[model samples]
Target: MSDAQFWEMNPTATEILNEVKARKIQEINAAYTAEAQPLIKEYPLVEQQSWTAQNTEARAYLAWHADQQGAAPGTPVLDNILMGRNGETGTETLQQLCLAVIENAEMFTQFQQLTGKRQRLVKAVRAAEAVEEIELISW
Candidate 1:
């Protein structure tokens, strides 16, 4: 059922539903920040060179591609070309070189585990899926 239908059917449970939704949003946000933000932040550093180098290299690549195509490098072509240079392969290539490097880096697994709060959240959410069930913890 749609959210509105559910709400209409169970107006009295609205407060509990809203609390669960709010908590889910908070949990997802926390997981994103903890697990994903740093990896995303490193994208520019890993994908492109420094500012000066980026500009110079991109311009050169554009000039070369334009010469070959006999037209100015359009935005899409520039993006593809730049991505190719970043990978030293076609735009659709898998296994970016940096990904392999990162995998081998001493910090990779630690970074992934620490940042991967979604795994933990998934387990918690799965357990909570049976809302009618009670869980007891032994200390």
Candidate 2:
């Protein structure tokens, strides 16, 4: 039912309903923040968002294709590129690359296309989130 219809059907429950909705908003925002905060600190905001978008893309691809596989999913292409570069364990290599991205920001021509894709993804995500957050605040 629509909001007006539902409210008419249960006039006495409006306060309770509002409270429940408010609590849910708080809970959802808290959950999103709790998961996002550490990564936000580690990368600049743009890179953190780029990583999230890249992860989501990779995960969706894996979900649909994993069982039909020739090879089971392994590390992401981005991780593989970094790993192959250093011959180190994945984490250290990725950390070093991320730090390099932050520090140099202009030195890696080979990675330029990959980084460009991430840059675009980050901009799009930020724009979309800005609109969503504005709407969420009205609730």
Tens digits of per-residue lDDT for model 2, 91-121:
4544455454444333333445544554454
TM-scores, one per candidate:
0.33, 0.27
lDDT of 1 by residue, 1-139 (tens): 5567766766555454454544564666576666556555666654534433334444554455546666543344335545767676445422242233334343445665654565565455445533332122110
lDDT of each: 0.48, 0.48
Candidate 2: 10-residue stretch with minimal lDDT: 130-139
TM-score of candidate 1 to 2 decimals: 0.33
lDDT of 1: 0.48
lDDT of 2 at 35: 49
Runs in model 2 deviating more than 4 A are 1-12, 52-139
RMSD value for candidate 1:
12.4
**Clash pairs (backbone) in predicted model 1:** 35-115
Q: Candidate 2 local accuracy as lDDT?
A: 0.48
